[model samples]
Each structure stands twice: as C-alpha cells, then as structure tokens.
Target chain A: MISRTFRRRVWLVLCALALGLAPFPVSAQQSVYIPITGAKKLRLALPDFKIGSADPAANSLAQTFDGVLWNDLYQSGLVEMVSKSFYPLQQPGTPTDLGGGALAAWSAAPTTAQRLVFGNVVVGNGALQVEGYLYDLTQPNKPFVLGKRYTDQPTPAAARVIAHEFADAIIAALGGGPGIAESKIVFISDRTGHKEVWMMDYDGANQQQLTHLDAICYSPRLSPDGSKVAFMELSSAGSRIRVLDLLTHRYARFPRLGGTNATPAWSPDGSKLAFSSSRTGDMEIYTINANGTGLRRLTYSPGVDIAPVWNPKTGAQIAFESDRTGLPQIYVMDADGTNQQRLTMSGYAVSPSWSPNGEALAFSWRRTGGGEGNGGAYDIYIWYLANRNYLQLTHNGERNDFPSWAPDGRHLVFAVGENESWQLFTILADGTSPAKLTTAGSNTMPNWSWH
Target chain B: MSHSRLRYLCTVMGAFAVMIALAGCRHKPAPAPPTPPPAPAPAPTITLNADPTSIQAGQSSTLTWSSQNATKVELNGASVDLNGSQSVSPTESTDYEAVAYGANGQTASASAHVTVTQPPPPPAPAPAPQPSIQDLWNQNIKDAYFDFDKSNIRPDAQEALQADAEFLKQHPDVDFIIEGHCDERGSAEYNMGLGDRRANAVKDYLVQLGVDGSRIRTISYGKEKPFCTEHTEACWQKNRVGHLVLATPAQ
Candidate 1:
C-alpha cells in the first residue's frame, strides 16, 4: 500500500516537468501599410457660344466650329455635355440679388443638371477669339475659366482651332494623359506600284514614303531602338541583307556568306545576329557577331534550315525551321551547337517570330495536304512555351502569314490576302475580330518596331 | 567338587563379558565428499603480422600472417585467388589479404596491394598509291593535242589507255568506273548528254581491244567537274575529258 504523502509528491513532480517542457508562444513583427491617394475627379462645364455672324457665306464657319468641338469632346471619352436645345434660352435671376446663393441658382434649372458652361464667340477682321468658363454646380464659388486668342486666321477656321485648344487645356487641367487622337502609325504600303516603307499618323493621316529601292525587298525588321530597319533585298546577284539608317538615308549590307542570304534576325542584345546561310554546302543556321566577325554555324544538317529567331529574354537559345525530317518543322537548339531538339511535329511551318515576353512563339503553319496555292493560305499560330499547347489565330481560308507581335504582346500584326492583294491586319492574341489596317496593294511581311 | 565350583565361576565371568559386549557397538569414518573441478581457463587471443598494404605501379608483393590456435582459415582482401602468393600482370595489379578464425571466436587478418603499368598501342598502316586512268593519261599527254571537231583518242591517248587495259587484264576481277565530262562552253543539258556518248565510245574500243566490257561502267558529270579555273581555250580543252576509278574485287 502506498502512502498519501508519497503519491502527492509524485504528482507535484509530474506537474513541474510538464510545465518546464511546454512550448512558448511566438509574437509576429509589426508591418506598416501605405494607402494610395487618387486625384480628385473634376467636372468641367463648357460655355455656350452664339453664332455672331449669320451671313449666308459664313455658314461654313459656323458648321466647322460645331463639328470640331463635337468630335474633340466625343473622342475624349471623359466629358458629358448637357443638351443646349433641351433648355429654354432665358437668363435666371442673380444669386446675390435673390434670397439664394450661386449653388441654389445653378441647381434651380433642373435636378439632373450637374454643371454649367457659358461661352461667347466674336469674329473681327477674318480672325476670332473665344472665351469659355466652366462652373461646378455643387460648389458655386469654384469656377474654372479658360480663354484662347487666335490671330491671322479666318473667322470659321479660328473658331475650330479655339475649340481644340480649349479641349486640350481641359484635358491637361484634369490631370489625365494626353489624348492619342492625333498620333500616327508608321507602316509599309505598296499602293504606289512597288513596296515602299511608309509612315502615317495612328489615325491614318500624314502619310510619307521612306524606302525607294526598286528591287524586291521584304521582311522589314525594325531595330529595338527604332532608328534603323534591317530587311532582305533581292538584287541581280541574289538576296542580300541590308540595314537602312532611317535618319541618315544610308544603307549597309550585312556581310554576305557566299550563297543567297535572307532572313536577318537581330539578337536581343543587338550585339550579334542570327541568320541562315547556304555557304556550308547546304542551308544551315549561322550567327555572326554584329561587327560581322566570328561567324559560327549553329546547325549541321543536310536540310533547309532557315528563319532563325532568338528568344528575347534569353540569348542562350534559338528557334528555327529544319527540313531534316523531309518536311519543314520547327526546331530549337542552344545558342551554341548543343542540345538540338524538334519543337513541332506536324505541318510545314515557317516564319517563327518570338514574342517580346519570350513566353510564346508566333509562326505560320500550312494546313496538312494543302499543296502549292494552298501554301499561301497559312494560319498564324502561337505555341505556349509552358504547356506546348498551340492556338490558331486566323480562321479565314485566305493567306495569313508573317505574324509580328506588338511590343505589348497583346496584339499581332500580319499580312492577310484579300481580293488577290495582300493587306496588313491586326488581331487580338485570342483570335477575336480582326481589323484591316491597310486598304492598298500587295503589302506583306510586316515587322513591328520595338519601341 | 572343586573342579565343578571353578567351571561355574568361569561360566558366570563369561556370561558377564557377553552381556557387556551386547551393550557396546563399533562405527566406521564417512568417506570425504567429492571435490568440485576448477573453472576452465579463457581462450587465447589471435594476432596477425601482415596487413593490407598499397603497392605502386609495376610492383609485386605477397601477404604473410600469424595466428594463435586457428582451426578455420581464409584469404580475404581485393581477391581470394592470390592463394598465399600472387603474381600481378604487367598491365594491372591489386591488393590482397589473408584471414584465419578459430572455433573459439578468435580471428586474425593480413593484406598487401600490388600495382602494374600498361603498354601503348601499335602504329597505323601506310597509304598506297592507286592512280586512275585520268592521272596516267594526263602524265603521258603533256604536249599531245586532239583533232579539231573530234573526241577520238590520239597516239598518246592510245598508249595511256593500252597501259591501263594491260593492267586491268592482268587482274581479271578488277573493275573500273569511268566519269566523262565536257567543257563549259556548250549548253549544260546538251554537253551532259554528249559526254555520255564520248565515254561509251571509249568503252566499246576497249572491248574490241580484248578488255571485258562487263568490267567497265560510265557516268557523265558534264560541265560540273572542270579541271581548269581559267576561261581560256587551253583550259577548256583540258577540261573536256574522262576520269576513271579503279577498284579491286574486295574493295
């Protein structure tokens, strides 16, 4: 039989050991959070201007002013204007003279009225000056006034310029980015007989011609810095790679490799080049230092290996097309001659261009068994590097080839054959509705400039 | 009467002695208990003299051992095939060991390593000079000229072809593959077809000259296999010709 005192001593010892072995609670460190402050939303009101000149010959001026103002505001996508004809043309009583403040007088017009804009136009000596004031209905004392003075301009045209200037100031005062309504897109158009690189505003205005070479030139690749263009030109001898200095109007040839040379691809670093050469008894992929020395061959198969493109993010690997399997297929190999592997298993594929993000490869593939004329009708496809899944971006039976991805990688520009003439078209990466960007001649092989 | 009284006294004395004997008993000493045996002595420990030692290249060595009362014996190291002594090949050598164990759980071990060097490979064969008909013809035709508007063999050409034919006849199984070529002045397609005719003409002449026609075959590589790089008539004349490839039956 055990004693009670002995049992109590054992229990006390057990409690002490349990308490000594217990784990301590941990405390987390404190962190600071910063909140982002957004700019205040300001509503701008436009002033109403009456047609001071009603001369029959001056009607064009009135129409031009109204047109410019309406188009500018509509394109802004920011301002909402109250209908002028919906309200009666009567002046309300002065706020100080009445028992109400400016806010009460502004709100007295209508419950839906948020702001008010008043303006007047005066024409003199074939010139015009317009002044406008924007008043906030909620805060009567806070009103923004803007004025524009135009000289050496006709009464009709001056009003148009004043309206545009007013819209520009309002956009800037509201702390918004500049409107791109006046920007342009520089592209190549063959509308004037031969394919000549052209530049126009993004809205299709101010078109200008750049290249005048009479020979056949294609595959215009823009430099990453956007100051030069590297393209392929066919002369009496054969195809030669040339670079055009956009600023100097001078051109230099990428050193020739004995046989026909085409498809000049600039490395991501812009310090080297990867191109195809047949000088080694067959068409194989070759890379040369940008200064043209150290020409090393990267592929050694008895097949037509062409269209070498480098991964934009990593200069250590290159993707190209090889016919070693008796048909054109996509292949990838190290920047050096190691670890050569095929990436695609079907169809005659060509013209592989890497996306700027290096996450996908955009190439053109012909439908199987589609021979000869069917060769022209290729579908633009993208291969996801992570999953090896491919998505076709074009559904039209017409030819779609030479896909060049935009700098953002969200859209792609390619040449589409329509009505027997090739035109430039842009489509979303998901193969949604495509928009025709050019309406003229046979324009093919568009390379977007990396800006 | 005196004698009877003495017998009675003796009887009484004897009877008293017998009574005293019946009351007293004699006892023997007990045998000493058996003594227990002493505890057994512990087993003797074993010791070895030779240990596994490394040897340099081209060296040979032996393993030696010593043990105490060992009944079971073995040699364990890099190999058991050494069998007390090992002679390593000159190309490769290795370490060895000797081990012994007794039934009383005592064990001993010994080892030694040996090494050897390797030899080099043999030399390559010499190249042979196998000249073709074109080489022989070019050597003998240093100044020989062909007739105008004709591809017939001249005197020099005949001498060269005869030597080649004689060489072929001596080796019955040997065959020759001939390639005919033309100058670059004529149309490529026409010259290709014409070169074939010139080679056949030569082959037919060889057959009539006692050479087997079955041993010869011809191909035309027209305008492609030019002998001279210049554009002059002299270069063109030399380029318009035939080439021959000779081979043995086993080649």
Candidate 2:
C-alpha cells in the first residue's frame, strides 16, 4: 500500500523510461535488413481505413484493404499492434487529422502507440484511390515515416494489392529489406485429380492453377524477376524440363534433352537454368541458356548429381545433392563444376535451397540410420557456409522437406507431411511460428519466389 | 603196351624190392600235400539306375541300385545297403554313381547319368496353350529395386538385368521402356532426379550386358504413381524399382 503521490511519481518514472527507450530514427531510405529478432518491435496503431465514397462496394473494399494491411504489418514481425479497444472515439484518417491533440492522444495513456498507420480509400467512376501514411508518433512534431498514393480499379483484388503496397512501404521504412508482400509462392498440388503447378500469394491467398497439363508436374521454380517459371513435367514425351512464361502466360520453348531431364532451377540472373539429365547415360547437373542453347554439363561423376540450386547472391557458386559417396549428401561447387566439396558428412541430405544471402543452405536431412522409412525422420536444416554450423529449423516428427527460403531470408516455406497427407507450411528461420499455408489436397515441392 | 610193359614190369620187380627196402628205412614219410582249390571269381559287379532318369528344378527322382558279389556298396560317396533305393532332388544336372567292393579287394563302379533336366513347367495348367513373347517377358524380366535415395545397380539388380538382357536379345524386334519410380519420400523434384538415375542405371546395365541401347527408353515417375501405397518399409521398397514395360507405339 502506497500514497497517491508516491504512486503518481512511480508512474511518471516508468513513462519517462519508456519514452527514452522506445523511439529510434527509422529513415525511409535505409535498405539494410534489420533482423526482426534484434530490433525492438514498435507499437503501432492501425485504425480502420476511412471510406471516402458512397459507392456500395467502397465500404467492403475499404474494410478488405484495412484488414489486409493490418495482417501484413503484423506478419512482418516488425510491429506490435495496439488493440482497437485502446483507440479514442475519433481516429485520424490522414496527416491533416494528426494535428491538435491527436498525436498526443495516440502517444499517451492506454494507447501508448509509438507509431501510427492511417489511410483513406475512395472509389469513384470506376477507379479506386488510396492515400496511406505512416507517422512516428513518439518523435517531436510527429514526423512522417511514409506517405504514398495508389490508384487501381475499384475491386477486392486491387484493394488487397494497394494495402500490401502500403505495408511494404512501412516495412521498408523500418530498415527491413524489400518486403515480401507482393511475392508469390509456386508449388505442386494434386487437387485437380492430377498433379499440376499452382501459384498463391505469399500469405496463401489467391490460389490459382498455373498449369492444366493433366499430367504430373513438379518443382515449379519462379524466376528471380517473376517473369517465367521452370518446372519438371512428366508426360508421353518422358520426363522433361519445361518453362511457363508468366508474362505472356504461354509455354516457352525449352529444348528437350532426351532421356529423362528433371528439376530445373533458375540462376539468380534468370538467364540460365541448371538441371539433371540422363542424356549421357548418367544423371548429372547441366546448365543451359534460357533459350535452351549453349548447353554445358557441370558434373561428370558416376553417381547421381542432381537438384542444383544457384546461390542467390552470386551466381558463381552452385549447391546440389549427390549420392557419390553412396548416400545422398549436400555439396557445393563452383559454377564451372571445379572445387567440388561435400557440405554434409553423414545421413541422407537432399533438395538444397540456398539462402537469399548465399551465406547458408537449407535442405531436408534425415540424420540418423536406416534412411527414410526407418526410425529417422526428415527435418529441415540450415547449414551456414562461413561458420560451418547447422541449425535445425524443425523438430516435429512429421516429414518436413524442400525448404525454400523466403526473399526476406528470415523465413522458409516447406512441405510438411503428416498421416500421408502433405501440406505447405511457412516457418521463421529461428524455428518459430509455423503457419500452415495450404489445406486442399496434398501440396508439395514449394519454391518461394526470389524477389 | 603188352610186350614192352611185361618186360619193364619184370625189371621193375627186382628194383621195387630194393626201393621198398629203402622206403622202409625212410621212417614214415610226410603225408602227401592236399590239392590246391580253384581260383575265386572276378571283381564285384554293380548296376545303378535312376527311375525317371531326369528331373526339373524342384522335382525329385528315385535312384535304385544293386550290387552282386560285393562286401560293401556306396552311392555318390555315401554308404548304403547292397541293394537299396533313395529319392534325390538336385537343383542342377548331376550324375548318380554306385561303387561296389569285392571280397578279394577289388572295386567296380557304375554311373546312371541322372540328367536332371528342369522339370517341364508344371505341365502348364489344363489347355497348355503356347506362351507369347509377353508372357515370356513377364516370367523372366524382373524389376530392379533400389535402396533409399540410391541409383547404383545393386548386385541383385545386376542378376535381374542379366535376365532382362537375355529376354530383350531373344526378342530383338521388341523395344521396351524402363519406368523408374521412387518411394513417397524426399522432394518430388529430387525424387524425379533419383528416379531418372535409377532408370538410367538399369538401361546402362542392360547395355553393358549386350542389349541394344537404341531399343531402350526411360521415364521417371518420381513417387507420382506408386506401386505400393502403404507407408511401411516393405511397401516403400516395392515402390522404388526400375520397372520394365513393353513400349507402345506412342511411347
């Protein structure tokens, strides 16, 4: 039990401490990826976007935009959302409304929001207008962190896109690398009675079938620029590598190297592809120009040398899976196939996906005896090239495989199998917050876009 | 014989009296030696016969044998009665032999030459229709299984490929496709690559065995269509194989 004056003094001291430690200068031009785990999560208020039009669809579209923006910011792991219950009866919808006592109300008392994201949506004559802003509330004079305008057709799709843009701006302003809001994930799904390639948003929305070949298709690797996707297709022509032009939505001509070609992976520059082909009576890694000419074999070993993934930072190095030592293990080599070195020493490791920074590799590994079907379970592991340290990203008994790194380098999307049903799941690189991305039919072999 | 003998007898009578006197002085001469017995018969004779004379694999044949004037009889180096019969099943063609020992230390042997031919396949049930090339292939060619994430032609796979090569060579006009499959493990893309390796391993082995390479084609169905659907090791093993199929015109 304390006196009212003593309690008031303690509260003042705590407020002073919070004000001293909370605010950091977040410039809009900084491009470095500040690790979310290291950066203090800022408290941000994301009030509902104000609807500025009488159009019947504007109400729902604004709601959709506001919801999507909030989710994106929350999922970025860079901010802690201030509950709506803490908001005052009147919330600012634009920079002009941040005048008077609005900033003081948001920065004080129960709201205590150090940052605020406010926007307004308008629909008129067939076009949608969105003006979004981010303000640093804790700073003197409440400086603007981000302010942008987006215009598109007044549709739900456009609303979601506009909201994603605003969230990306806020993320980039906070010292995170280019946000992954607009990124897409391509994977294989069997929902249509036949396995085919499918594409979905980074958050598992807008799932659309990309291929209707009605034959088994797998390993859809989107190009770095998101213009084309290279996949492995099995049909009457035998197993071959095919590319789908995402820009034109047509099948691009990829030369058929006879006798079983598979697992086409795009180089960082998207000018070439590396894949495994048996044309020489052995499965070896080969690279060909995007137009399918200038074919060159990069491996000549006797055993299988397959699943080649180019390092995203620099295309000079390639990592792949090889069973040359009698068991599948991850290996790295120069682009010319020289200086071949084994990265994994024991157990079965395959499906090597290089991290976006090229400093590490993520692969599916069964590290115990007896291989698959034995007691050992396949788990995702990240092998750091510089430190030679490995971090196990999953410990679940379910089969977690094909770990494709997200563009942010802080997350991975992999196929998780349980009870014979496979689904896609995204997990943080630090091995937290495993969120399932797909549920309809079995989905597998997910490849995250490189953008 | 009449005159000469009478004269010799008169002369001998005077000598005989002297000889008798000399014999009486010899004091009980040794008893006359007994006459020697006739020589024994020659070495023992043996006859061995296989009842059916020949048998296929998994079939049995009876070996009957008899020996005359022999102290001991043995069949195929194993001792047996002088006259006996036994059932023998030999996986390969063999010779059934019998050896006999005579009383006077002489040996004689005879071999029946069982000629264990592969038993004519269970008299092909009922109608006994002639088997087609497809049937022959289905009976002889076997799928080569792979270990988890392996593509090397195993020792057992080599044997299977040898038999497949023989069948392919016998039917030169028939072209075939090797469908490589994988278990429900690993990435589909990598498994595709693994399946490709497996199919290529089979084709390369067949080519090494003198099968024409141009007549062979390969495809990999990386865990897409599994031969066994269960999640057990045995089932996974069944799914991981290089299965040979008769190629259709479109393929």
Candidate 3:
C-alpha cells in the first residue's frame, strides 16, 4: 500500500510538471491581456484625409478613406479618438505639415491628443494613391510613428482597402498586436434564393458571394491566412465539408469522405483540419490533413462530439462541443485528442470558439432553465481558461449563437434571431458596442478570419 | 373464333332481310296510317382523335376532340369543353372515349386509341435510372421524433419505428440511412452529437426488431439544416426527427 501511494504521488507530480512546462510564451500571454486590462488609452487625433486633386471623384475617395480609417481605430478599442471639432484649423495633410505650431496646438489645447493620424488621397489615371502618417505628438521633434503609401484602382473599395492597411499599421505600431481592420468575415447567407457561402470585409463592406452551389451551406470557417474557407454543404448526396479556394475561385481537391462529414476547423498552421464525421458508423471528432490524408479519429464516445475549433495561438489544444454528459457542453482536449477537459459543468453550452490568443473561449450558452425543453435563451459568453471565470457578452433574451472571435480577440461576431430573421452582430468581448453587420436575408454562422 | 364469325355473319344477314321486309311493307302499306309525329331532334355527334396516336413511353400526345349539336360533353368521365384539346401521357396503350348528349336523351360517342410503345433499350447506358426504391422509401418510411435533446425512443417514436420496421421487413433487399436532425435552438456542433445519438437510437431499435444491422446506416445533420425554420416549439419539435432515405452508396 505504501508503494502504491508513493507511485500515485509521483504520477501527480509528473502531471504538475507537464502543466508547468507548457510552451506558452510570456510575451504571447501579455499581448492578449494588455488590451483587455489596460485602462489608460492613448488619445489620438484623426483629421480627414485631404483631397490632393480638384477632381470630385478624388474628393469622394478622400472622404471614404477617412471614414474607414476612423471607424477602424474606433473599433480597435485600443485608442481614444479625439473629436473632429477639437482639431486645429491647420490640420496636417502630410509629414511636412507636422510643424512646431501644429504640434503645440494639438498638445496644449482642449484637444490635447497624445498622437495624431493624417493622410491624403489623390486620384489619377485610373488609380487611387493614398499617403498615410501617424505622429507621436509628445515625442521630441514629433517624429512620424507610421507612414505608408498605397496605390490601387480608383474606387471606393480601393480607398477603403488603403485605409484599412493604414489603420492596421498604426495599431501594430502602438504595440496592439496585428489589427483585424483588413480581415474578412465568411458566413452563410440565403439572400440569393439559396443558402450559399458569402464573404465581406470585417466592417461589413464589399460584401460578395463566394459560392454559387445553389445548395445549402453552413458554418463557414475561414483559414488562418484568409485564402480558403471550409464549410458544411448539404447536397443531394449527403452532408460533407467542402473547402473553397478563395484565391483561385475553385474547389481545392478535398477527398469526399462519406457518411455525414461536417463542421471543419482549420489548424492554426493550416496544415490539417479537425471535423466530426460518421464514416465509421458513429459520430466522432476526426482530424485530417488539409491535403485530405492523415485521417485520425480523435473521439470515441457513443454520445455526439463535434464542432472543433483550434487554439489560434498555440494550436496545441482544441475546444469543441460535446454532449457526452447527457447535456451539451464545452470541452477542451489536446490537439491529438488526449487530456480531455470539460469546461462547462451545468449549462447547455456549445460552439466553443477559441480566442485568437488561445487563453479564452467564446461560446453560446443557455445558462439556466432546466438545461433543455425550457425556453432558455442562449447568450454569448467568454470563459477565461486561466481563472475558470467567465464574462457574459450578451444579455438580451434572444437566441444568439455561433460566436466566433475576431482576430483582435476583443470582439466576437455572432448570430441573433430578430423577428424570425437571423442577423449577424459584432460585440466587444466585454459586452459593449453591439454593432449589426448584416441586413440581408438571414445571414448567419459567421466565422471571422484569424488574420 | 371461326364459330363466332359464322354466327356474326348469320346475324348480319338476318338484319338485312328484316330491313328489306320493312321496305316492302312500307310500299304495300296503308291499312291504318296516321299523320306522322314531328321527327325527333338528331342526336349529337362527336369526333375525337389523338394526335401522334403512337408515342414512346414517357412522351405525351394531344387528344383533340369536337362535338356537334351537343348540350353537354364528357371525355374519360370528366366534363370537358365542347370543342377543346387535352394533353395525355399514357404509360400503356389506352382508348379514350368521349360522349356527347343532345335534347330528348339522344347521345353519340367516339373513341381515340393512343398506343404507347416502350422505348428501345439503349445498349450503352446499361441500366436505366430507377426512382422506384426512392419513391417507395418516401411513401413507407415514417420519421421518429424525440423529446428535446433526448435520444431514447419515446412511445410515439416507438410506434413510428414499428411501422418503419414493418415496411423494411417486407423489403429485405432495400437499404436505408437514418438521418438524425435537431432544432435550431441548440448549438450547431453539440446538436450534431445529439443528432447522431438520435439516429443511432433509431438504428438500434430497428436492429432489435430483427432488421439486419448491416443494411442500415446512420448520419447526423445536427442543427445545420433544420426542417422547420420557425422559432416556436411546434416547429422545433418538427425539426428534431430521425428521417429515413434510401441508402445509395456514398459518392
């Protein structure tokens, strides 16, 4: 008996050591928490983009660029935007305009913005050119923090693109991590008389249809690099996960695994996909290589286990939805399907989407009402993995579901039921700024890109 | 056949002799002839023809019909316009009759023959596509429903499975797939698991009822594709079911 107890003690120590030696870097952990807990936000002045040409089209392009940039900064939640009314009469249009007088005016007046963002847009021979700059108003000599020049076709879309690029650059320069301004959101839309996959900008611009299969599609998850989308498609044959190559506008060769394969989650490195399949006569979680090889079955429960989402930061663990405990709940397991840990105990929780930093999960939960059969309204909640604490992101008693994280890790896009029509909305992780993103027919199942 | 023909010939000859005798009697008449009553109105006459009277199987033909002096007309026991055409697709050779009626109960009738020829079997296509099993599955199979998130067969679900089993037992050669489905109230992924359980519950019950387990397959649609897209309880109940379809080999 003594030897047995001693062996048990050793085993426990080994587990503790294994947990302690996890590969999570300190810098990665800090990057995720700093934006959430950091209270002192830098106030930044965003003057309108100056129109370089007298052409009316250039004037519109400048307006469009300035509006997109301003919105991106506001959505980042990393900066305080100074009101335009507080701006000095002499706003900077370029780096040369950042003179002592302009800097002193911005730093001293009621407009005391700690930083400044200024840009200009010019239209020429079928091309739109944009010059953007970010200035540290408090720095000695007021050095330019970020300056970028972009050229694209002379269109509002191109203007928005340049603005997004500049906004992302500014966010990164401020040590806010990679910004999601230029990221895309893929979802299922039934606007074209069929449930087909669609894509749009992170801020709901340039909405475009991606698949014309004329068949029902669901749960679109964009790849980490924004080059492909994997989603469940229900054709006459059966339900299968199809990968669409966004760059080529073609279906990349994915093997047709039979027997109801669906809800594919891409690995962080884009090398493999984890999905739930019934190829062996039972629904189980399986991981397959992106090239359609290396198929590995991960879960063995007779109960249902599905909807796997990889940890974007480490890719070492996966959070998925399972009903093995007689009620649907959120569960996490190692990437190879070991070390299964249940994250939700008493509520009906599912669709566990890992935050970009891999430190927390956002999911839909009906936390009350007898688990099932009762009219329990689902709300989106974030469960922090470190402290095992959660923060509810939605309070309205509507059926909000399919919570997916933005690349910022501070915002989530989810579907809400309104007047029997489903729409997608993006809300901050702290339960603020609920912005509606879709107005068309029943847009749902939004998956924000990792980038 | 010869005997009947001889009898028919004798009857026709007798009819001719009687007609001749009547004509002779008319010439020699006048014993007690009264003033002739007003002649009765002529009966209606109808001409019916099926255009392209012969066609390959699955092809359609037009039945063009017209009637004269008719107050009412009927084609194949259905009332029709006096002078109209109808499209008819007959799987086999059929004779369509049209009857017209006039005043004083007078009537006339005609028939059009539409011979439907079986199409020539193509040598290269090998086997024709048949939707019989699919149609039979749709007609005979009944979906089994479960309570919210519960996979155990309820009393109502048991009755449905029993009826399904009766049909399956009679068709031993047929194979089918049980698709487990869920309502939109649950998470798409977890409902997948629930759906799978529901499907397997159905499969297990069928197997217990002496069905060949190998002949049955199961799939989980989860909540991705809801049969009923409403937010009410009735619609959600309709969405949670184990639907049956003919199990063609997966492609």
Superior candidate under DockQ, 2 versus 3 = 2
Off by over 4 Å in 2: A1-39, B1-130, B152-159
Sort the predicted structures by DockQ, highest score first.
Answer: 2, 3, 1
lDDT of 1 by residue, A1-451 (tens): 1112323443454464457741332112111111112222233333345545544434566456555665555344344554554443443322222234534444455433455544445555556545454455665555433334444365554655566666656544543334333333445566787656675432233457778886556556666666667765654344566778778978864577654455677788877778776554356788887677899988888655777888877877898876677446778888896898877676567678787778778887773632111234578888766546466788797767778766545456777767546777766565653666677566666776554
Could you list the iRMS of every candidate? 16.5, 2.3, 2.5
Distance (Å) between predicted and true CA of A427, model 1? 1.0
Q: How many residue pairs clash (N, CA or C atoms closer than 3 angstroms) in each of the candidate models, in the order given?
A: 13, 2, 1
- Quote the positional error of residue A39 for candidate 2 in Å: 6.4
- What stretches of model 3 exceed 4 Å from their correct place? A1-38, A95-100, A125-127, A140-143, A370-372, B1-142, B217-219, B223-230, B245-251
Chain A TM-scores, one per candidate?
0.61, 0.87, 0.87
Candidate with more favorable, higher lDDT: 2 or 3: 2
User: What lDDT score goes with residue A234 in model 2?
Assistant: 89
Model 2: residue B229 alpha-carbon error in angstroms: 0.3
Using DockQ, give the best candidate's number: 2
Winner of 1 and 3 under DockQ: 3
Candidate 1 local lDDT, B1-251, one digit each (tens): 69999999999999999988876644445789999999653443333332224444444444454445556556553433313443443335654456656566765665555444443345667677787654654453232223221345677657667776776676667677555556654222223333443455566556767889878765544444667757566776776665656644443
Which structure is stronger by lDDT: 1 or 2? 2
